[model samples]
Target: MNAINITSTEILSDSWYTLKKISFEITANDGTKSTQEREAYDRGNGATILLYNRSNKTVVLTRQFRMPTFINGNETGYLIESCAGLLDKDNAEDCIKKETEEETGFRIDKVQKVFEAYMSPGSVTEIVYFFTAEYTNEMKVHEGGGLIEENEHIEVLELPFGKAIDMITTGEIKDGKTIMLLQHALINKLMG
Candidate 1:
């Protein structure tokens, strides 16, 4: 088995939302000698989506414009994602709870963790932990409040589970974290 060890790490930039750094390393696979550096966005406090299942076989999602992708020619950049967020010293359950209320205004009674992944293992070290919450029509969700000042304009949408999967396969839902959740649900037969 090949193993890599970290010799040292240096922070090139730091901010409330992002951190850029470089690292000195050694690869034992074939005595590969090299130095690697990465620019990482702290993205402090990850993100989440509320999958509220309404009657008629539909689940609620959010449509929001992502600036990062917008510049890349993704005109809308509107994403269909599940409820998720960063650990940030807070356990997965707690963080999800907070994001659920903030993003969708739905109070979750129960949560089941689906999966977790590093958003971008190549350059950034952002791990998005995802889960599914069982919500009923009785739940009261207020007018969603997102980071408007941050230029985030979002609209809540309810889509059929099958349609959501189709969106993922068709590349309509492009966010890595959201894809992870949808794939897990599909593979595990949990999207009821």
Candidate 2:
């Protein structure tokens, strides 16, 4: 296999997040080779899950404040998104399960892997694991709104699947992962 040789990786920032500048020699598709340098943001990998109930015709979601959106264009900084979090030290499934409960207050037992994607490939190195799970009223055990210590003040939202899907067109939901999961559900006929 052809390989891209990494010559050097220099740390540019080491605060809340990490940024590294690297020089690498890459081979083009036409068999040409050249050296390039670029900075990459390493926030680590994460997982996202969409909880849906076929019988109830509804899905679970979360609303939270994202500073990046506010700075970019949103005035309130609030976003409607799927339950997600960084993988930390656990595997994708485990991380998604823990995040689902912590942020939405629902403990899920079984989850099926839907897909995996790289949300941002230009500068950030984050590979996200996408999943969907079936849930019922019996699965909810706690009042979920995220952890105070983690500074997560999330709001749990259980909306009709159809309505939530329509939200995408109306611009109510803006998160990428949420959009993908919603479309997946529609295309896969996850709802009854």
Q: Candidate 1 at residue 7, lDDT?
A: 59
- Cα deviation of 116 in candidate 2 (Å)? 0.5
Q: What TM-score, to 2 decimals, does candidate 2 have?
A: 0.95
Model 1 weakest 10-residue run by lDDT: 47-56
RMSD of 2: 1.4
Instruction: Work out candidate 1's RMSD over C-alphas.
Output: 2.9
Candidate 2 pairs with clashing backbones: none
lDDT of 1: 0.66
Tens-place lDDT digits, model 1, residues 81-170:
665546677877888787676667677768776566666777777766667766776665676655566454667666787888899778
Give model 1's clash tally.
Answer: 6
RMSD of each: 2.9, 1.4
Every candidate's lDDT: 0.66, 0.95
